[model samples]
Target: MHSVDHRFVELLPTPLERGVLYISGAHDIVAHLCLCGCGNEVVTPLGPAGWVLRYDGRVSLSPSIGNGALPCKSHYVIQGSRVHWLSKMTEDQHHRAQARDRDAVRGLNPTRLGRAKRLFTSLLRRGRV
Candidate 1:
């Protein structure tokens, strides 16, 4: 697969389109289709405990995204608008990665630690962690 191109928009489209990433800093949302060709909509929020967006002329998302739900359990990192596929992680590895992501969020904003903790707990409850 090629690097997913992105466009910054004030608002994301109602139904996201495939092969395009619509970024909305105003809404703190980044919408795009699954890079694994699942045709599933992936919306990553820009915030602590969510996703961190970086733009060095091109957009990048930190900590990667792992879709463990449904038929497509794709795992990959989005950097420089490029999708770097990752080998499927074991259950223990997935749990460890979740902890690392939670820690990253807390480390980034100590003041929002509680909020990050809550988000982590919620994800854990949903078996998404």
Candidate 2:
């Protein structure tokens, strides 16, 4: 298992260091290098529809980060500053995951009217109502 040093920052550093997770509450984002040593910058935005960050001495992020678009296609979860690697997803799995994410984001509308509209639209698309 890999480990990462967590830092709370107002803004990300010029060049992100490897093995470090830079979290910016001010910007609602987290940035770090790929844990697979791929030297790619992976950023996770914080929000209702995105990853959630928690801290109690050690940092944790809800929902795994899947870099399917990246060459390495790394997938992992961060909990208590420890990296737990996951198996690579197939192309079909990736497409389904993307669709689930889109639906999740669409359901996060703040207003009741907005949510109702989205629910109706989704039902229409599914031919369920």
**In terms of lDDT, which candidate is strongest?**
2
lDDT of 1 by residue, 1-129 (tens): 668888899866656677788987765668788888888777676786578899987878987887765357778898887888987655666677678766767567555666555644754564433
Query: Weakest 10 consecutive residues, lDDT, candidate 1?
Result: 120-129
Candidate 2 lDDT tens digits, 1-129: 388899899977868899999988876678898899998888776776668999999999988888787778888999999999998756776787789767777777567336445644753564423
Q: What's model 1's lDDT at 69?
A: 51
- Model 2 is weakest, by summed lDDT over 10 consecutive residues, at 120-129
Q: Which candidate leads the pack in TM-score?
A: 2
Q: Local distance difference test, per candidate?
A: 0.73, 0.79
Off by over 4 Å in 2: 110-129
What pairs collide in candidate 2?
Answer: none
